[model samples]
Target chain A: MEESATQPPTAATPSATAAKLAMRHVDFHYGPFRALKDISLDIHDRAITAIIGPSGCGKSTLLRTFNRMNELIPRTRVTGDVLLDGTGIYGPDVDVAVLRKRIGMVFQRPNPFPASIYDNVAIGPRRHGRKEPDVQEIVERSLCRAALWDEVKDGLKGPALALSAGQQQLLCIARALAVEPEAILMDEPCSSLDPAATLEVEELMLELAQEYAIVIVTHNMQQAARVSSMSACMMMDPDRAGVLAEYDATSLIFTNPKDKRTEDYISGRIG
Target chain B: MRMSPRLSQNLARAVIWASAVLVIGLLLFILAFILAKGLPTLSWDFLTQNPSDMGRGGGILSTIASTLFVTLVAVVVATPFGVGTAFYLTEYTREGRMTRFIRFGAESLAAIPSIVYGLFGFIFFVITLKMGWSVLSGGLTLAVMILPTIIRTSEEAIRTVPKMYRDVGFSLGATKWQTIATTVVPSALPGIVTGIILAIGRCVAETAAVILTAGSALQLPTSLFSPARTMAVHFYIMAREGISMERAYGTAALLILLILVINVAVNLLVNRFVAKGR
Candidate 1:
């Protein structure tokens, strides 16, 4: 059931550029089993889009699809059109490495490089071939963006592994920002984090959404409600494999939805 | 419930203490055994003179020099190869049948006897290439034989380097090679160094391959192609064919001292590195 309107969305939002990422009947497979089934949606530009679902559902897999990070895993294949900035990102010309740079990713657990804070942030910009960067400015701006400068400014040279779990996760966010990526794909960024750390990351995500498009996969429905501007729910069909059963704006998905599965999921009846 | 988990864990306290003592005792016994037979024979004459024909009377100065030159060259040769091979396997390559085959080959090579390596050296360097039993041939052979040891240990070191470092570099837009050079290689330095030092020890202690490849000669090595004899080879020759038993004993003492000093230095460096890593 499409949200048919008398007015065309393309004509109305042409100048505004409503979608940062759009998928057209995208399908994903791990060997023979399909993880995402003929799914399609527009990830709103410069807004936090959260995907919520039960374990083993395709929520995390879908977020990974944005940057093509799933290509890193063996036996994983994706089909159909996955577009970024109106360009099909999965086309033959798209370099996965280059694509990854434009759309930075952060994983569930904090994974800071075994290096100094300055080096960690400088890694992305420097790798993409910028030599002798104004490392000081970029590091400061990125960490400040992630709200970690006050905690680690004086100890930039210290090993990043020395930080607590929360600080390390923020460091990862800062690392993602260093490349000046257009979007950030987060795969359960707060799942391994404590509530306090979770709040810190959620707030940071909200703040970051003002600059970069954010698509986060979180199992927490409350987290989906708290941070996301739009929410997508996925479920494994009874006779089928992994699939996106429902997708909608956060307000529409949580309070009132046309799909029975989406309502059951939001109310914790089928979870 | 009555006892703390810590206390219960200490249930094997006696066994652990006894095992520790036994280990220390065994190590000491070996050291003492080597020293007891080797020390008194060490003398200025033993250090300065040449080996007496028929295995005994002369000094090992030339042999000592040859050992140093050969090891220095072999290590220099092995370092790049070992590190490169390790980098390829650990950082660049993905796991598959070919990678698995290469890994298995390296493991098997590491386990193969030094004598087998010596035979391979003799066949390849001397007989096939016709390099004719020289210091260069010996050094090259040793380096090749030690390749597996170097590769295996270096791979372990490189593997231990957290994957995050590579990711950090890649995310920064560092090319595949760039990430390995800047982040992966540097982070694994201590391990690579440890592997190199251990390889150096193997080179120093090795007599089989060098003896088989480089003809055993007492003369100072003047050129890369000239036959040279290492200390271990010299000692082996003395023990088997020397003129005087006293000279052989003296040569033994000197060789033991050299091996002991090098091992101690490596141990100290490795310990310091482990402390830093911690």
Candidate 2:
């Protein structure tokens, strides 16, 4: 596949911009089973960094560690440092709720609450104690940011579940954006969508990357090549734990990967 | 030789249809018999006047009052505890020895007979606690008898809510309690209310437990401390003593109507909630 000419050249180098998130010597385990082995990486601000790997290779697990979403799973443990804007997120003083407000997430399937379209977007800001007037503004602005406001503005009182699957996914994005997070993590956001919806989401991701730090874990390598500025490839070790195999600009990862395993996986020879 | 698939399918269908018809036909026959015998006895005065002459000559307003009061107490006292325990089991605590133990206890409690519960209530609430045979004792006993039903049903209802909703709530920066209160509980409300309605039905239909703990007084109960006779207990006494078979059937018919009305009203309320949620 050819690299798009519109790809940002500055992201080809790791040191060109300050990192928004920095992880060092991180390892994760679920009970006695190690899921992620020693990993270190830097994710720059205002860029879409894609993590691509085969199933069970811990790509989603790595994405989850950014906002401590992994803590929701029982018996899961993480060791080492995960820093956001140079402050350790795992520190004793950090409030997880406040931490999550600064870093939002969108899941694979569209899970709009069984509530009105307006209430779904308004829920986050309302949860953080934002009053009605400000919440109204946030709802409209967030929906606009998600590119869903135009279709839904007239029927904000309608049930969110009544929307098409693609629209529901976008509504989830608006709901996540309502709290105004600095970074967004998406886990296979297009896996459940039709090709048309996938294209729309891809366009939205490109637009969102200009403002928020975005990390996406996808099995679709072509999708990574199409949208991401930087890309990281993961592979399972002989012991079945996921390890970082390669990290580079999306163009380099697709065209000139330094690791032989990365080359084979990219060319569909091995996973 | 093995039966043909078509023949086997036909046999299964016939048996299922017959079973359903038998159940419905039996229920209708019983209801028709009671309504035929008791409809002539019912009137505004019968519903509103106090019974006299050992329930041979007067209406059943006092017994109705007693039934309502006892049911109100049972439902009011048990609802919070039942629903709260359900939330605790499903959301707050992880699945472990403690949750299993609590579930086991509730299941065992459900297995005990109502008459056995009456004996326990007679001994504990009536004799030991000195609450005496009154509305308080009877209601509290019914509350205990129905707790397991509410907890089991409510827990199952809460579990049916999609886990994705909780994940979304947490990802939106909601605290644990906030997530449960807003997303989880609202989704589970209809099922929980259904369980509470079932408990109310059980309370209204109880005879032995009420007779033992509430006593068989025919007067209109003045307070929670007043000994009273529920409609079921009164029906039992009237028919057993041969005081008035007609009046007993009247009470039975009214009890059935009252339960049917409650079921219909709650169904309407639940449908409204479901429609709003959608």
The model with the greatest lDDT is: 2
Predicted structure with the largest DockQ when compared to the true one: 2
lDDT by residue for model 2 (B85-179), tens: 99999998999999999999999999998988899989999999999989999999999999999999999999999999999999988999989
Clash counts for the predictions, in order:
17, 0
lDDT of 2 by residue, A1-271 (tens): 3322233435444432767787788899999999999888888788989999778999999999998889999999999899899899999999999999999999999999898999999999999999999999999999999999999999999999999999999999999999999999999999999989999999999999888889999988889999998888999999999988888788888999888888999999986
TM-score of each: 0.87, 0.96
lDDT of 1 by residue, B210-250 (tens): 89988798887888888888988876776677455555556
lDDT of 1: 0.80
Q: What tens-digit string does per-residue lDDT give for candidate 1 at A1-271?
A: 5442111222123322467888888999988888888888888777777888778878878887887766657789999889998899998888777888898888888987666778778877766666764766788899999999999999887888899899999999999998888989888998888999999999999888777888899889999988886777888877456676667667767887777888888898877
lDDT of each: 0.80, 0.91
Question: What DockQ do the predictions score, one after another?
Answer: 0.28, 0.75
Candidate 2 global Cα RMSD? 2.9
